[model samples]
Target: MAKIKALKCKECGREYPVEPLHVCEFCFGPLEVEYDYDEIKKNISRDKIKKGPVSLWRYVDLLPVENPTVGLNAGFTPLVKAENLGKELGLNNLYIKDDSVNHPTLSFKDRVVAVALSKAKEFGFDTAACASTGNLANSVSALAASAGMNCYVFIPSNLETNKIIGSLVFNPVVVAVDGNYDDVNRLSSEVANEFGWAFVNINLRPFYSEGSKTLAFEVAEQLGWKTPDAVVAPLASGSLYTKIWKGFNEFKKVGILEENEKMPRMYGAQALGCSPIYKAFKEGRDWITPEKPDTIAKSIAIGNPADGPYAVKVTRESNGDMEVATNEEIIEGIKLLARTEGIFTETAGGTTIAVLKKFAEKGVFDKDEVVVAYITGNGYKTMEVLEGHLNKPIHIKPTLAEFKEKVVGQTINK
Candidate 1:
């Protein structure tokens, strides 16, 4: 009668009880939440989802939680049609699943933290913590504040100024490690073990990662109960990308989607500076080779992604591909989306858009195929990346003549 069956290892198929564990002792592989799809199929239906709350909790039956009490207002972000962006990309059906305005943190991290913290409360934890690149720190700090739990966030010392301030504003204990994300993660693991606190990405990762499936659930429900033809998402630890693949498949498995509907071709996007997954995919390898982080897209600059192999597996099995974009291309991608669709996204989203453009140019997507590009974080948190790239504001005297001569005149001259 339980909602979930057990925590099963992805490699050895070993199972453990529902607890704060993420690894299998037998194979040293990652563990995932196993559910009863037959029971879920009997309970979930289209009519039930339509009548549920507007947040991600609408798919609570699919997630790894019970009696959710955190992030009540999170999820249910807009799936914009993106007509202007679609025209520029030469694709007829392009949608932008914008999580830039996600509740509390303005990033998709809120989704995972929401589920993680809620489950942490259920497990009677008084503190919520995480190792973050940027957005996850903000999410944990803000959401933990809302849940009235003591919060600690660890991040690289060189993270963006705005992101640091974002977490500080929530009054959490923020630690800045003198290294990249992987290094910070190593230290956080030690801290989690010592403190016995609920490290969202460490001990509660199975529940945390399950939250990302809501993005796919919302996308399907918004698209009239159908899946997109293709999905291009930014990859960091690769959890989001792989979970989305799982989400769509789970929908089919639970009988939410029509029998004829198929999973989308999953495309993984990454910055050329830290593109381990991209390299692995290109080499046709089922494993990942770690790289050093050196890109403006810091949010997705994980040198050693924990879920890199699984992301590669999803892309291959779904007949998908991966691509990387240069720093210059990433900036242009941000500018293009802003100009075309009026969405200001961070470098991670920029990387995704740049790769989407490349795939469009290569004629990878059919003209009528429905493609969705996920914009995960708001650009305001990463404004420094666009400092010298964006056009400067024109200055003039406070007069109508000056406005016409400087602004209107320049526009007409062009």
Candidate 2:
């Protein structure tokens, strides 16, 4: 039997049966999955999890599903000790939680889509769908294809060509909305109501968001069962940021880690184009105001983030903060990680890296603190953003002298 106990409203604390619901009928607040943690504690242990598969299912006892149907090898990505990147920023201990190489789809969305589709199947849904900016669409389409379910992916019309192609190759029904991500999400919400499809981030959201906890699980496990001093994650709907903090705390409650140490400070990153959460944090407000996104970080471009207030609260409670990155800084961040860590990540990651650097400059992170910055997507999916920015190939003749003049001479001069 699934360990899920109930669906609880995040605002008014009303609990309901585990069903295809995402909002409270009374207060109209978002709902979250309530698990039977006591039963989970009885079955889950470090030894038990270590013996399971290296995928997200390694923590299956903690996940909501009893029968996972997809992404058998997602999660458990490397927590790289970014010595070069750390040195560049004058920090002694910095790491990159590189989810850009997650299995099947090579993005963190694979983790969420895996669990969401599993829950969809458990609920007897024959179709799976989502309103995504890019990564989630790619993941949902690919996983649904593998599961033999009809898939529909809705996205803003201005999504990157490669991201659109990423979902198309999976042969799912693709819908391009006429406006931004918020517009696409609103339309998808209406479609979910009319068609009754298991829209992953809509009706199936309580289950879908649980997948992000695996990132935190892997990070703590990778660091020898201890939370890092700080974490920096990109904020889209702010779901990932909040879930990661929950994962660490859950581990402590289950006796997997010590609670005596200070909780990891949770920092959030956002592109200046859509920085509602950051703005709220900066103004010391408990609420967020939406913005019209206009940035290259399309993957994290949710103008009205659903969990923006919660993200702000989490950051403040953890004694952390949020920061924004400009397009120029974001591009520079992408190049810095590539040159330093050989990890090519998407604009969301660039935003994360840029904000991390800003924090380092502001003395937000102590020099010896263990900091982990998450890189959520592969840069290959957004190569168009680097068209004129990256160095082009040097044209030269076949002759050795010509090669020397064009290539070797340039190298020598540099």
Candidate 3:
């Protein structure tokens, strides 16, 4: 009655014992943790989950770890009923899965790092590491420090300044590579091989990716055990997007969701400057052609996504579409979410919001259809992206006369 069966290859269906492995020897395809869902069904139920801890670990029956020791407080972020945002978008049933406040790191990466590091510890690894754009770096640094493990995080040199500081404060050895995210990942792979460090997204990826399924689990439970009609989530390496789709299906497989409930259509969002998944989806192709990263949304600016093909497959299977947003549109999307829902999200979230708007405008959703848009990180990490795009503050003195003339007068005129 083992919860996890093996690390099964995504292609060629090869199976290997659970270890810090991510690729198949025979096919070189990615490996994923295969579970014994029938065993899970006998042990899991709504009441069991409800009585568990109020965190991602509450769904421990589904995650790849047996005892999750890192990022204990991560996940179970708020699923806000976006009444204001819904009205603005002309949709009545819209929600925002706000992971901007996810514990320890303030991003969805916390969930994955939690599982990854926990599994790494179980595998007798002393060091935790990852190649990141921003959020993953911050998560690995913070969580690994909390777990008392030696940590190293690699990221592109040009990542946002605040993100670099976010990792630095956690005291992990941070490596700033001289290229884009893909380059950083390549270096991390070599380092993981050379040093035998548990790179969370590399050698430990089969376990790390399972953490993202908790987002889907939380959303379904939060929505009263019903899956949404559609979901719009940002795509970086496309892991999060595909895992979310997997989560909903898993719930159904475990009998947690009602037999009458339907799966959600999965919409993938990307920035116009780097949109290999969107390009592949639109052109009716199944494979991704890598693009050079060139977007303000640096977090989701992956040129070559490891899970890009799976993401496209899920989108097509779910009857969903992929879309990209320009820098201008991404900025507006951030502002719109802030103004309407009071949620200040990073560029990744802005990309999601913008694509959600496009889906709404294109009549992709009915008026009463349930839609959930994921906001993955806090805007504070990437505030520089909004520079000169927001209005300058009204520089009024302590005088009420100046306030009335410069602020109140202008307010009234507008």
lDDT of 2 by residue, 1-414 (tens): 656789999999999898889999999899998888888888889998889998999988878888988778888899999999999998898999999999889899999999999989999999999999999999999999998999999999999999999999999999999999999999999998899799999999998999999999999999998899999999999999999999998988887887584579999999998899999899998888988999999999999998999999999889999999999999999999999999999999999999999999999988999999999999999999988898889998799999988899887759
Point out the higher-scoring one by lDDT: 1 or 2: 1
User: Residue 61 deviation, candidate 3, in Å?
Assistant: 0.2
Poorly placed runs, candidate 1 (over 4 Å): none
For every model in order, what is the number of clashing pairs? 0, 0, 0
Output the lDDT of residue 247, model 2: 91
Q: What lDDT tens digits, residue by residue, belong to model 3 across residues 1-414?
A: 299999999999999999999999999999999999999999999999999999999999999998888889999999999999999889999999999999998999999999999999999999999999999999999999999999999999999999999999999999999999999999998998899899999999999999999999999999999999999999999999999999999999999998878999999999999999999989989889998989999999899998999999999999999999999999999999999999999999999999999999999999899999999999999999999999999898899999999999898859
Q: lDDT (CA) for every model shown?
A: 0.94, 0.92, 0.95
Q: Model 2 clash pairs?
A: none
For model 2 the local lDDT of residue 25 reads 98
lDDT of 1 by residue, 1-414 (tens): 366999999999999999999989999899999999999999999999989988998999898889789898899999999999899889999999999999989999989999999999999999999999989999999999999999999999999999999999999999999999999999998988799799999999999999999999999999999999999999999999999999999999999999889899999999999999999999989889899989999999999998999999999999999999999999999999999999999999999999999999999999899999999999999999998897799999999999998999897859
